[model samples]
Target: MVSFTELNQQNDTITELSNVLCHLIDERSVCDLKVTCDLFFSYVDQVKEHLDLEERELYQSMLLHSDQNIRNTANKFLSGSGEIKRVFGQYLKRWSKNKELRINDHDQFVKDTREMFQLVFNRIEDEVEHLYPTVRAVQAAMPK
Candidate 1:
C-alpha cells in the first residue's frame, strides 16, 4: 500500500500544477505561452496516468475484490468523477486552441478554465479523501 505521505505529496504537486495552469491562462503571456502549454500538457498526461492506475488497479480491485457495500459506494463516487472527466476534456480542447483564440474569446475561455480547475480540484480532493482511506483500510485487511 502507498503511504499517506506519498499521497499527500502527490496532492500538493497536483495543486501546484493546477495553480500554475490557472495563472498561465489568466496572464496570457504570448511569449512563454507555447512553453507553458507544452509543460501543462505533459503534466496533465502524467496526472492522468497516475489516475488511470488508481481507477483501473486500485478502484477495480476494491470494487471486485472487496465488500459489496464498498463497491456500491465507489460506483456512486465514480459517477461524479465521470462528469468531471468530461469537463476536463472540454477544458483541454480549449487550452489546445488557446493560441488561435481571438481576444473576445479569451474572457470566456478563462472563465471556463477556472471553473474546470475548480471541478478538477474538488474531484481530486474528494477522491483522495474518500478513496485512499478506504484503500488503506482494505490493504490492512489483506495478508502479505
Candidate 2:
C-alpha cells in the first residue's frame, strides 16, 4: 500500500516532468521533439502506475465501503479513468508514430502537448483537492 505522502510526491514528480516536456515542445526542434515524446511516454507510464495503485489500493476499497457516499465518489472517479486512459492512449499513438517529428507536424504537436498538460494538471488538482481527502477520510475511519 502506497502512503499518501508518497502518492503526492509521485504527483509532484509527474507535474514537474510534464512542465519540462511542455517547455521542450515549445522549442520546436526535432531533437527536442524526440525528447518531448520520450518524456511524454514516461509521463504516461507514471500516470498508469499511479492510477493502477489508486484503483487497487484506494478506489477498490472505497467502492466496497459500507458508506454509500464513499462508494459513489469512488465510482465517479473510477468512471473518468477510462476516458483519461483513452485520451492518453491516443496521444501515445500520435507521438509514437513520429519519434522524430516532421516540420509539418510541429503545430499539431504543440497543440496536443498543451492540451495534454492541461488534462494532466486538472486531473492532478482534482485528485489532490477531492479524491485524496476522501480516500484519507475513508482510511482513517477504517478499523486499524
lDDT tens digits, residue span 1-144, model 2: 779898898899889988887777676664344565577667877888887778888887898999999899899888777778889878767765544333458778789878987887888899999999999998889889
- Candidate 1 structure quality by residue, lDDT tens digits, 1-144: 456676567667777887877777777554145676675665566566556556665666677765987787578666765776677676666555553333346778688767766876886788677877777877788888
The numbered model that scores best in lDDT is 2
Q: After superposing candidate 1, which stretches have Cα over 4 Å from the reference?
A: 1-7, 30-32, 97-104
* Model 2 misplaced stretches (Cα beyond 4 Å): 30-34, 98-104
Candidate 2 vs. true structure, TM-score: 0.88
Error of 2 at 134 (Å): 0.7
Clashing pairs in 2: none
Give residue 72's error in model 1 in angstroms.
2.1
Q: For each candidate, what is the lDDT?
A: 0.67, 0.79
